[model samples]
Target: MSNVVVQPTGITAADVLAVARGTAKVVLDPATVAAMATSRAIVDRIEAAGRPVYGVSTGFGALANTFVAPERRAELQHALIRSHAAGVGAPMPREVVRAMMLLRVRSLALGRSGVRPLLAEALVDLLNHDVTPWVPEHGSLGASGDLAPLAHCALVLLGEGWVLGPAGERVPAAEALRGAGLTPVALAAKEGLALINGTDGMLGMLLLAIHDAAHLFTMADVTAALAIEAMLGSERPFLPELHAIRPHPGQAVSAANIHRLLQHSAVMDSHRDDLAHAVQDAYSMRCAPQVAGAARDTLAFVEQVAARELVSVVDNPVVLPDGRVESTGNFHGAPLGFAADFLAIAAAEVGAIAERRVDRLLDVTRSRDLPAFLSPDAGVNSGLMIAQYTAAGIVAENRRLAAPASVDSLPTSGMQEDHVSMGWAATRKLRTVLDNLTSLLAVELLAAVRGLQLRAPLTPSPAGRAAVAALRDAAGEPGPDVFLAPVMEAAREVVRDPALRTAIEREVGTLG
Candidate 1:
């Protein structure tokens, strides 16, 4: 089971992933609760003194300088949530929405947002009841936080918008909130900004995408091992001694992963004695560790960013216990925005090489001892030909998306909101790359496993065979080209399953 440790004031990306995977729970650290109390006391004192504050007595965003009539301030707060809930696009996946909810609530819990403990508690209640706000995917500037999207999240507190009720029924926000015995929260000073500002929505999704992409990196190694041994590719490139002299961690990790896959394999035995099938084979095979290691390095950098940020108090007008309000740039997402784009490039390369190997697996001229297309009929069936085509297309699309969204920024907020990161765009693209790469690897997994199927009853690498068996059990042998789309998706599920991967690793040992 997955779980997250909510320390007195810390939230980890792993914690979010655990809750996302249905393996754990989230609770406030006792210290965070105290911080909330302290901040709320400061806010109450300020409001009681009738001193005009930013969010408490003023408008937000474009209307920042406009003052809200004191008598109508509460009404303005409610209206802000409703008016800003203008997001349009397909609704985000339920898991992402759940993550957004937790992130937003946790951000507010730091007490810096000036929301009442009851408000934070209600968010917890909503999440516990499994009532997630149906937030739209588009409409974030990646600045002033993820305003429009989070407005959808805050809508649940207002008894507006749609929610996934405990019974799994989609119901009105009011019904879901009331049924859960939670009340709408009234935003206090900076509460509205705190509720909506920050990179929670994008960060949550990117964090999960990043974690999964890391797993995909390993899967790429396992699948690549099959292509290597089948093609009689040399394993000398992965020797630990080779990497030790250069000393790149990602390169080392990729080399290690391959070593794990090739352990106990007979296919590599003939590579030296056979006098060469096609000389040295393609760079994708010979340089798999090197190319893929660069990707691992990129992932490592991205992980560092997420690991550092998830526990940070990202929402702004961050509270100071001494009653000083210092506005800062904590809300900016340039760091994560750039990280998202970087990892997409890494993931794309991971897919790009896997696609090359799939091409190799399908070509009779290249795939030693294997039938054309890994199918008996070859010319008549076309077997895995189009699968390679599909992979190529997805890889190209990934290339286009890999252009950093963080590098290009459009000025907003009348130049006040200038220097936008568009980090949300980067994170969103990273997610798409993840999906694309999953299917790309799946196609290869299908072709490789199919190749392994022919060797059936013969044997695969101790680890490779088990990996193939797990897919075969779940997806069955690819007898005839029926509906392959489902098979591709199913194969992806097998690749994503951690247990199958662990079994392969245990049998094969470490890569390098």
Candidate 2:
């Protein structure tokens, strides 16, 4: 793909992903550069006149009243970056740092942060050359932007911190800059604050999580369909007419996906006329759409929040086109915080429901005659009983993680930043929840596919068969249990594999 030309108002979630994944390059639009120069001129006029600006001549936060001499103005910007670059713990993933860099550049390119075009271009150069800063996972309260984390990012531009080279080795920022044929730029008035004061860290993680969650939501439906067919459950509950009366768009989409996946199934037809079969399946089977669909709807709302954030100027002291510099609470991360926490709740519930289905599939009593844990050699081999335990453990952890981090706030910066969003913490945990959900769904898919394989001469729907075939191709057929960890891990990989979804789609067409 060609480099993504970032216009002030047109950065999308996809653009962020492309840059994060290293598939596309980024360039600031010429018009954006011109606007930024205009903003920078306003800052220079203010500084030259020795007029007090919040982040220019005056101190930050509670220190806003303190005045500084003209000679010390550049030192103030540099000091702010060095003092705030105090994040601790393990570094954030390289992809996340790349997204943060891309977003910070995008925010500056909007022409409201009063940063020179050179600073913004330097950020773009860092990304384009693949020199990722090693930002720690902690330090931001998510109130005054992702201060510490973003400072770690800005440290690299000043040739002070460490960066991951293109070959994935850690090197000094100076070395990385020299290798990339780039030089560090000096910080001007309010430029350091502009770089660090925003919700870019949390927002970056949120965007990436949103992207992954979109796919996982669909994968949840696909795996649930396999479980339903594997257990001989009726597809009648998923019929469009049955869902039309309720009329939730997400529910309807999920139901339609399930219906399509089970079309013309010999396994389902075999039980169609049996009165001895239970009149209806359990909630895990019958209510799969309701649970998974709620997640889908939650994702849609999160996407809307993310989309608005993409175009927003989240700086602290924003420079307006009319030349007014105002200190505002636009830097607070409450918006992203709430969205991340909300999505974590939705994701945990999705995994919880999938775990229940996995439990049912393993229990001989509840599974409608599938062998205990799908084990042909019952007593001698434990089969997939432990896999349910693993999923259950992860589901329990997810429940704990679902508690809203946004609600837990503590005072900082001498009570000036007393109420923080804790949004960075929220988004961090959301990434974990997503990872757990992926593994949990993989476990459910593995057990369900095994149950389907045991069903023998009765064929699943063409879509269902295609899904099973995809899993078998990736992990081989399930049989008398051997070392199952490798198989389960392989199954997890298959769940994440796009090809598996594509193969199923070729048979049943597109799913929701």
lDDT of 1 by residue, 1-512 (tens): 44454554667776786676584656766677777888878877777777666776777766768877767877887888888898887777878887887887668766676667667666777767777888877878788778888888888877789876555556788877777777777665566666787988888888889888888888888888777776667777778898898888888888888876776765555455666446666888878888788988888888888887767777766666788565667788898898998899889888999999999988888887778887766666767778788999998998998888888888876787877778888898899999888888888778877876665455567866786777775557645555567777788887777876877767766443
* Per-prediction CA RMSD (Å): 2.4, 1.2
Any runs in candidate 2 off by more than 4 Å, and if so which? 165-169
**Residue-by-residue lDDT tens digits, candidate 2, 351-387:** 9999999999999999999999888888988889999
Whole-model lDDT values for every prediction: 0.77, 0.90
**lDDT for model 2:** 0.90
Worst 10 residues of 1 by lDDT: 1-10
Q: What TM-score, over all chains together, does every model reach? A: 0.93, 0.98
Steric clash pairs (candidate 1): 2-23, 145-198, 256-511, 256-512, 257-511, 259-511, 260-510, 260-511
